[model samples]
Target: MKQWWIIICMILSPCLKADNLFIEAESFDKKGGWVLDNQSMGQMGSPYLLAHGMGVPVENASTLLQVREAGEYRVWVRTRDWVKQWDKPGSPGRFEVLLNGKALRTTFGTEKAVWHWQDGGTVLLKVGENSLELHDLTGFEGRCDAVFLTSSLDLLPPDGGNELADFRRKMSGLPAEPEEAGEYDLVVVGGGMAGCCAALSAARLGCKVALIQNRPVLGGNNSSEVRVGLSGLIASQPYPNLGNLLDEFGVVGHWNDWEAKQDPSSARSKQIREILQRHPEKKIHNAGPATNYEDEKKQSLLQGQENLSLFLNMQVYDLRKEGDRITFVIGKSIISGKEYIFRGRLFADCTGDGEVGFLAGADYRVGRESKDETGEPRAPLKADRLVMGTSVQWYAEDAPDRSGFPDCPWAIRFTEETCVPATRGDWDWEAGLDRDQITEIEYIRDHALRAVYGNWAFLKNQSSKKEQFAGKKLAWVAYIGGKRESRRLLGDIVLREQDLLENISYEDATFTTTWGVDLHYPKPIAGMDEEPFLSYCDVQEIKPYAVPYRCLYSRNVGNLFMAGRNISVTHVALGTVRVMRTGGMMGEVVGMAASLCKKFDTYPRGIYEMYLPALQTLMRQGVGKPGFPDADKLD
Candidate 1:
């Protein structure tokens, strides 16, 4: 009799009354054409589901919700009007909510620039499973963070920022303290080519490593999400064997157009054809195939190492510091609401934003430094907010039949005078150099999107070449913004342009940088009313210079190390070292330094001061696989 009573109670428990229910949009089982976007979490407070319709309305996003009571519940949704910044009359990101196959009276995603609650009148929910759906009304970009249903008439949705963050944690029933992920000798934040090499190099040397990336994929810029072809020469001059690991892990074949045309006269073309013949599964086309991003290949390589652990979709938000050292970092999954605490003796800040260094209170700089500050002639006479712009590359496909694109009124308008008569958006298509790349990332990305959509609309509908583009359809546009520069974490030595021009050698030199000082600016094109999306670049070649080990670690933070574009360099010097391949070599050197830290039981500064000779010996011997022909060589 007691067992029967307990079973009955267990079945009846869900039917009991409750005050409220919270549903995170990202946690929905069936996303259906919606993208999980966590890029604005720092500013908006939580990851949201984005219906990034490029002028065509996407399918509805539905989720199953269990109600505790069958009664009238007030509905509230968190969203924003993305185009509100333009002070536009109509909201581009408008959507509707449906409950149990019935459309609600209120329309969502019409709020202003800030994230807020949009009231959806009373709804009748049953005391069982109910279908909750998000219907995009416009073919722009509609976003939904979370939905809240409450019985109390006075209860309102949580406001944005820290309050919203705390409310999310409470609503999600996440633990108050972060769960211990694991202990490691080294923890690397950022999963770009640099971070991957750093973690792999350290792990191969028998150090336990934890590589945490905010995105679902491993590579950052090089990943399929961004699709930037690797540039700059690796395994050259000063350190011949330093970048051998890069060839082992990097994507094979250059993005040269000749390779796609199969021109036997070009050496690269013949080599690519031979490679494809050997491995038919690998495709080599223009800018290489989408597979060249190699998401699985990177994951497989990291998983093969027993000492290394890869954590994807984990965004590090906070860190615990003991004096000058970082003890552990706090990360939260973009998919799930679970929080993680990763403890390590050493930490590498490969995040291009320099997030770890910023959190640890390490000194850093943003934008361009004046000529007086670094004595670089190319720098501005007076310091101002001007840095290399971010890129949003895109491509189009030829359709057998003519295709039409909708007119995007909300996007930046382009006239025939300003129409770019091209089907591909390469490195030149860039913007947002004057804005804050870290805090204003969403705005920058949105601006790029507007540029692409607006320009394509003009070409297809209004431009003189409309007939030419009629048969072409928009194929792919990178949603992940390819950032060129951000916060430069200060180190013991800040590399300057003079170092590369004079070919100065340091005792702690590890890798060689062959790329010239390449900087970007928004140059005016004839007949354009406003600034063009395409950027103008200026390059000055210098002798192959060795990068110092002193520029790899933080000066103030004892256990902190950094690589990639965030390394210590002047705005002028960063022009050369910011290339992906050069950054990958920097990562290898940092990885070696991390292994040395473990062996000597010391910090980054200690490795430079006390054990300089040992590091030189390791650099001389090299850590990467030998005998693999150097794929990228300088003239």
Candidate 2:
């Protein structure tokens, strides 16, 4: 693995002085309807604006630019043909770069599959402020990273390399040194359930904490952007209050068909209605709607905290380390290219991909473990990179009028034989099972998009039951891929599936996990061979078992603590512990341990070695208010 110091200098670098005129699409004053997507910034080189209009073209995004050299400058847009990788037919991501109310001659996003500078010929710029617009032709998913304008046509921006990275620093006029974002007692990365709980717990315990989230919202998969419902049982057995923090902020657990609940003719509708009758809070469901996730509630909780500070749209690319301990971390705002340097005492790797641990050179494992290695029955014979897939969940709803959907020849083609005839695609609509979940995530997400649009196009146009779908239009499709498994940061004890199956107990056990060991595999469709778009799962049920405290903190990296799916566990054990609720409980335990670290003046391991009793007391008492069904009970 490349050291964090060497790899992330481009993104980590920030500046305020620039000789060249460069317009980052993310910095656009009026985004209109385009969304800022920093999820694939590492691979694509920078965060970009995504026009996710479902099937309808979105309103144009515009920004005013001040040009010092007002003249005919060669225009270049950083974009790509999103579906060109598979040699697909049409360009779904095609868009135009406009200058001062006039569209450019060349159409962008119709060229290379990889991120490249598409020449828009030359455009005239005013002496003062000029109106720049990104006109989206098709809202399928048009992306624009940055727009460059130089007097010299020969001076083309390098596609992607160390040179291009350095050029970005030069063009952005960012200074070499980073601005300080203040020191903290605890720093929690990744604003998912685990990170949120970790920050909340630590903050409530009177530790000045910093919670950094790449996206604008808090919850990762469970956020409105992704819309995955929280799963697994919370508040189980000893230290029942471990998950109590979740209750303070509403984290919905139930996963019922949202549409079916509203349908009087549907069988499950009655059951759903009855559930809601008893508890109106049961309105939440997987991929239900944007309102179902209640992102604002989570945001309010984080903002209301006295000791906790929230840093949204700040993606941490690199960290500074003193020996084994991380001294500070460098994160840049996705919107403004300014750097944020957070110095902290103890750091938590709640980033589900184990990003902090990976950057810190902590011992970690990716993919499945061999059966011989873990002695687990479910472990594969040979170790392989077959981790669980990423889900781009989608759903369609009845439109006010008969809706029209364009043919998606550029997307994955589907026929009656291969198509999944359903209005809503759930967790099973997964892709990139065989690909690297980290490096190749853009492809993974795009593959899922191709499958979704292709299937939707078929269902809307060519399916035998096309009349049944004529009234329905695509409502919401998650752009942010909800990941299941990734890099597992290794710790003092690597929990195995056999431990839960055999009901093994640990003296230092902290949080309890009750989710089944559910692992996903490709569904094996008839026609799809290039990339499987659907998946099936093999669920191995496990009793509520407490995870050892040793699994929470890193074995090699001294001050780091981990939660979420990235915790120290074999592929088999990740099945049970990967669920959001289980991960949240882990966060609660981690937070309690973090407070202990500050109090005893010790690291994460030292808390276990010297002050395990203190952590236990904190867990038993808990941080959240009781009687709200205990930490919003994930199950």
> Best by lDDT, which number?
2
lDDT of 1: 0.82
Which tens-of-lDDT digit does each residue in 103-138 have in candidate 1?
899888876687788888789889888999999887
RMSD of each: 5.8, 5.2
Model 2 residue runs over 4 Å out of place are 1-19, 251-275, 278-284, 629-635
lDDT of candidate 2 over 297-365, digit per residue (tens): 889988989999999999999998999999988998999888889999999999999999999999999
If scored against the real structure, what TM-score would every candidate get? Answer: 0.92, 0.93
- Output the worst ten-in-a-row residue range by lDDT, candidate 2: 10-19
Give the local distance difference test score of model 2. Answer: 0.85
Which residue ranges in model 1 land beyond 4 Å of their true spot? 1-17, 250-289, 525-532, 627-635
